[model samples]
Target: MKNTIFIALILLAGILTSCGSVKYFGIETFTPAEITFPETVETVVIVNNAVPQPKKPGYKYTIMGVEQDTTHMVADSALYDACKALGEAIADQPFFKDVRLYNDAVRQDEFFFQDTKLTPDQVETICDESGAEAIISLDRLLFNMEKDVFPFGEVMAGTIKVQATAVLRAYMPGRNNSMATIYLTDSLFWSEGASNLRTLDSYLPKPEVALRETAAYLTSGAYRNFVPHWEQAQRWYYTNSGTRWKQASAFAAKEKWEEALTIWQSIYEAQTNKKSKAEAAANIAVGYEMVGKFNEALDWAKKSLALFKEQTSDEKDSNVALLTLYEQVITSRIQANNKLNMQFGKE
Candidate 1:
């Protein structure tokens, strides 16, 4: 009996120790609320105008070929492939909804020979013809096959470095005639190198798949970088009326922690309603937890609990659901604090 009891206690201690280990300490946390764009504001409509052909065009695409810098033998097949890939990439963007590719062989060949240069007049004509809100003109300055070292060590690696610049211009015909241009002077070098068992074709995949994957990557990266900016944008929309507070709640639903935090913080600081202020304080703690700031979370949780306690009239006012949630917060904090203490060998 004595031996069994001792073994049980040891096992319990082991269990506690295992529970205290923070394996994914900062990895996974609560997502902030969802963000819904205001329904009243209309989404901007955009379109892609066709590429203008040069006056003396031969091939459908003027520069549809791979040009060897050393030899100067242009490969027709390579150039066509590249142009097709670029057209697919541009077509995939949400901003370019309505797109029309021009089919003038003479003009296209001429433009290609001129290093894909398009005059402002040509761009305007294309925009007017296509009835497109925006025009994206593509030009391939240099498309060359080259050898490159893979970031991950690999033998016999090569790349197709597509060095081209594109210009995107937004043109409004009648309304103020505002013109906005963006220069896409970036190199998209795709490595032919693959893992030990994979080939270059495997790595490059189809243009559609590759372009979609790239779009997803860009969109995710942009959102991650723009979290703070989006939060600030939300603040401008927040007002004293319950509407802004409700908007903040909607953002919280979408797991937009930063925006929800900002709005909740504002409400906590500025709201006159005691209940709303307390709720905001509690939500701020939740936001901190989502961001992996456990210490700040605990502090805010304590503040919320104190406010809740002050607001409660008696045991009658403290309903079961509210009490349970409050207890969960306190219990979770205690466990977290205890685990932190144990990790540091605190007394």
Candidate 2:
């Protein structure tokens, strides 16, 4: 009886092992799913007419003091430092590429100390000689200093305001001309605490930041305005009727269905006469046919034909093109409907 019990246990263990093996072999496994990155799109800067010059090494500038006085001598260092700082700040901008700031070499001479007025032509000539695109001409009217205390009595502060104007003229080497002239009048405000006073230094970084931002804004605006083919299509269409009609015909010939349709829609909206509206509608229908929108095309074509038939006078010559377009739309729509019926096994 013990042998018989042992035999039954052995058979049960073998069956369980086979079942485990079968289950292990039956299950399927796979590697984790893979992911893909999007394609990189290149940024295109369109430059037509005169190509913008490659941003070169830093530009050199001559900073000249346009005024002279006893008080001006006392404030000379501060004024010079301020102009140099402003030049550095502008050059640091991304658009500037590179720049160098320098004090005017001809100092306290006839041109520098006298009541000299530098005209635009004179400034341009200076720019040409210096190999610089811009110049910083300083004329200081007033530099005043004042003192105040903090509310909590933590520190005393001294403030200085420098009133002046800066002119930026960009040169177009390719065109052999200077483009737009920019003028910025700024009141430079500076403040210093007791510690800053001890250091003999105090100027707000805010003013410099604001100045750089303003320059960047002006430069971008100028570049955009200078671009030749950047005007809107709608504006072009409104200004030149012949050009607009030619564009409409060209778009239709190229099978640019949507563009052609848009041009015709504009014409229809602008037309006051029934004949012009009918003609526009007929052309619009032909555009729709090119886009495979047969029903819409057929509708517009029928409307155009009805208008042509209802005209009081025989203006057949005026509508010859429109009539031809209408017939083409009707024929195409019929063929398309027949094709659709056959596709669905209805005919």
Candidate 3:
């Protein structure tokens, strides 16, 4: 199924209010999988066991029934770069005591996917050599590449496309078992203009260049499977309360979260005016989110709604319009959070 389009669901007016309010909330846009390891697994090593893509140039190929034997066609480096990225990402986190990227690939003879996986014995030997408790083996990295020439204004452009699929297996030698094995598929598309279709190869880059660039994006992205990460997310707040908004905005700009929260909390609790109180409560919600206290953020959101309900006293009050819009915004957040929980197992 096509991914659900969030544009229609997003509260555009809330997007408007956030800019006006000088407030932002930390929304969990990405929920990566949790990492697992044996108790003895203090360090992990990554190795490439996949069959290497042919690197030799001067290979003849029939493209669109046109034959060409090209030179300077180097090897594909996607798997190697991905292996390095995974190790670097793990080392960047405090979660791992140590991480190593093995430069020497585990040479294999098989050219097919199923035949290229590392055996359990190979995994043990790699762990012993690298002095790692576990091993992340790149079993296979296969790419189906295609190039097409399409009309681009007065000229023509060649699109280089690739679908990369691979299997990565995590083995814990200490436990004598596999921790996690995942198959991933990623695709990339790039365009280069050409004056004519026949000369497209001359205009386009070497296949290895497109392969490396595509691999960089696709492989580094999949590395998130082993760790939790944060992604930028957009959220909205109320700024109609004017002075309190400015007061809170100043503190936020200074990065003094506690001081701003203090001011907003005071307005939320002690303000005599209902409108001011509700807006303050909403700001308080944003404050909680900014500090990564999502449960409190949710609680304050409920409190804001309750105040709105109290002010309306019925569904027909003039304040009901604002309340309805706010309700839609909150409901959208709840839906998004529910999706996050389901995907990441209730973080």
Ranking by TM-score: 3, 1, 2
Q: Estimate each model's TM-score.
A: 0.33, 0.27, 0.70
In the range 291-340, model 2's lDDT, one tens digit per residue, is 76767878877777677667745644334333543455355446645544
Give Cα-based local distance difference scores for all models: 0.42, 0.41, 0.64
Candidate whose lDDT is highest: 3
How badly does each model clash, as a count of residue pairs?
19, 2, 0
Task: For residues 77-129, write the lDDT of model 1, one tens digit per residue.
Answer: 33333334444444443323344444332133433434333455655565566
Scored against the true structure, residue 80 in model 1 reaches a CA lDDT of: 34
- TM-score (C-alpha) between model 1 and the true structure: 0.33
Off by over 4 Å in 2: 1-241, 313-332, 344-347
lDDT of 2: 0.41
Clashing pairs in 3: none
Compared with the true structure, the alpha-carbon lDDT of candidate 1 equals 0.42
Choose the strongest candidate by TM-score: 3
User: Can you write out model 3's per-residue Cα lDDT over 74-112, one digit (the tens) per residue?
Assistant: 444777876877677767766557888877878656563
